[model samples]
Target: MSRPMNDPRFAPLNLALEEALSRGLGSGFALGVRTQGGERFQTCLGLAQRVPTPEGLTPKHRFDLASLTKVLLTTPAVLALAAAGKLDLDDPLATHLPDVYQYDPNHPVRRVTLRQCLTHTSGLPAVEPIYTWGEGKARLEALVLQKDWAFGESVYSDINFILLGIVIERLTGQSLAALAEEAGFAVTPGPSLAVATEACSWRGRMVKGEVHDENAFALGGIAGHAGLFGTLDAVLNRADALVFGAALPPAARAAMLEKQTDDRALGWQIRHLNWSGGGLSSARSVGHTGFTGTGVWADTERGITWALLGNRVHPTRHTDVRAHHQFRQRIGNLVQGIFAN
Candidate 1:
């Protein structure tokens, strides 16, 4: 029988996480670990806010989930569409986004494919100041469409996933949020008691229940690169599905998990030394970290899924992430011990 609760050995994991929180590594965090054999654990620690009023972190408070949006929303949509024969990874951008490609002065846009974007080999710059560069979504997107492509190494550009989101939107004719729902996920659907994130000058206040990425904000808070928000359970459920063959078809899952770039899967990130997933994950383990102190990692070989969500940027974006990284490593070590036979 599967133990749906924590074992005493799990105490060290919780203590390390709580100590990190107490040290202000983040304002608060929610963590969950699950294995196929039914071993499970979850815990929350710290405050959701500290300046104006204190709100305790709970299992239910949604996190910003910055870049995890790629895995949680865009990637699955791409794989599901591929599985359903609705789109092809190798299809030219012109096939779905003809107007944007044809009018762009940069002809490279025409040659870019969903596959390159997914794999971050499309040569899109790692990031562009589109939020400040333009006035509206059209202008911002057009700016991206006109940028040059190098098409060689893995660049890990937000622009790549942003384009993927656009592709998904154009092909589906539905908002990314709607498609996320269709895929059994949710974005920042509405105002809620979400964990607070950066207190940005752009938004000019404490950011809560809204995205923290300025670019995604400029794009109406539903872009491929960021702008997802969800509870710990929502994230773990998605991670579990992805790892255990529930969310994606076998081929799609394989393709997504396959190392397209040295350290990157289709939309998820593969483990590397000192990565947030830490050293215990197998090479096949896949995960992504968010800027707002959130991440999800799955070790398929071990049937383990771990989610850590927090408002590390609660009052500002200047928080150093090294502590968060170390916390993950400690938790990873503890998990390794628990799963050791």
Candidate 2:
């Protein structure tokens, strides 16, 4: 059921998004939806940035995907590698990435596995300015390994994904960007296609077409935790692929989506009350959110995928998470209504 341009059933979605843009929840926003019957709909509105001149956003515009990189890039690569028999999820990180574990042979980090890292149960701190430790990769890796490793409780930690990226690179001999491209990300965007993000004071300008996470930025803009970028359509395409069996084989997909710990699937978050997908999400729903106001939610059971890409941190890197959460839920509900049978 292709929604016509004049479809009144979609008016609520349009109205809500337009109001959100007018209220400055984001300078620009794009929404993409896919239904169980393989129908797709997309809309783009507002400016990519209000400052430094107002540039309108379109479906082609690339937005800094922030933490979406974890699921979109790192997790898929690991699953692909696992499916190929290149590595096992439970293999100790030291087995695949000995260089990153060079600092302590007996360290608990030595025994940390890909599963722990992907599940955020590796006991790594929530964050560490690894870039400030030294200027190079070795220094960062050494510093990370030198930290005490905690296990048991699942805490979302960027360091876990950082090490996962290193593991992927070590095993595949390719950069995360290359692997992401192979996994179906739009790596390079033409001039008009880049959505503006935060006006970084450190970089002395607005961040457009570049990653916004400082740790990822310092790590040369490609880390396991952040730095992937994509357009609305591209992100939705990947989501469709992921849900429809193109991204992962049956066994791998099932394993990845299974609840491991802390209400999280391997790399995705199971939809819960008041989360990004809000009340619109069913128990079968899985999704992930990015710091720069980007997110994707898919219900394999219902055959629906909803994606939102917004420069929520534009003009600055601050916004109320509660507001965004509410906005996401509203959008989710509206999209569900439009596509409901």
Candidate 3:
């Protein structure tokens, strides 16, 4: 049989998670760890609320998954297309979505390439309130195309993935949401696993379970940047398939996981050196973080992965200070120790 969640090696991680929750780190959180050999350690804490419920936050509970949608849903499709020889990583944006550049005479969008988008070097604005436009997909696409695209410092930008999603849809003739499901994601209605994120200033309602990213929500809850949602197990299971080459061919998996740029694979954020989302235990790690107090990191070196899902944005998005970061690091450290033993 496998080890229990309370194994002494995991004590530090459990203690850290508990302490963080007690200190109001998040409304609730769930964590699951799987080793290379499939050894596992899982834990949950707090509640779906500050109070409690029968189905309180557990390892299976799905969280918003925030920006992780970029890597989880969007990037995978890009990789898949590349694997099929239908797309090129270095291909210019103008090749697929020529209109994005045509709409802007000042700064042509054609200059952007898939490689730049994946590496956050596309020079697109980090984010914009696209919901304010209240436009349809065509108009939204026009608005995005009209934006300037130039080289910039290394900073993550949602617009990169936003446009990337559009490219995927246009090339595959499939909606981002539909493609994710076909890629083996267990996406369900928002109210099922997800909790409400924000009662937005624009769309005045409690944005429950649906994607909390306004631009993505504006794009109809399935964008290359954010919208997809699923349980921790479901997401991890997908990761397992990628790592073990279940859905993708072995060569394709290698290509997907291969380091292309600094600390980044095709659709994954690499953890070889000490980047972010935790450290060395994060080495050999390829995972992503969500803005809404959620993250997933898998260390292929140790054959272990961890998923931390929480409604940190619940009630308010900015209330928590460093609790979530601390919690993630603590969890990473704890998981590392578990593998050490």
Candidate 2, 65-156: lDDT as tens digits: 88989988899889989999999999988888775557668777788889989988887777876766666666566666656655545579
Q: Is candidate 2 or candidate 3 better by TM-score?
A: 2
Best by TM-score: 2
Q: For candidate 1, lDDT tens digit of each residue in 184-214?
A: 5556655466888777887688777777898
Superposed model 1: Cα runs more than 4 Å off: 1-7, 104-106, 147-153, 189-191
Q: Relative to the true structure, how large is the alpha-carbon lDDT of every model?
A: 0.79, 0.80, 0.72
Candidate 3 achieves a global lDDT of: 0.72
Tens digit of per-residue lDDT, candidate 3, span 198-251: 556666666666777777777777678787677767667777777764667777
Which residues of candidate 2, in runs, are more than 4 Å off? 1-5, 137-139, 146-153, 186-192
Question: Measured by TM-score, how close is model 1 to the native structure?
Answer: 0.92
The best candidate by lDDT is 2
Candidate 2, residue 25: CA error in Å? 0.9
Better of 2 and 3 by lDDT: 2
Sort by lDDT, best first. 2, 1, 3
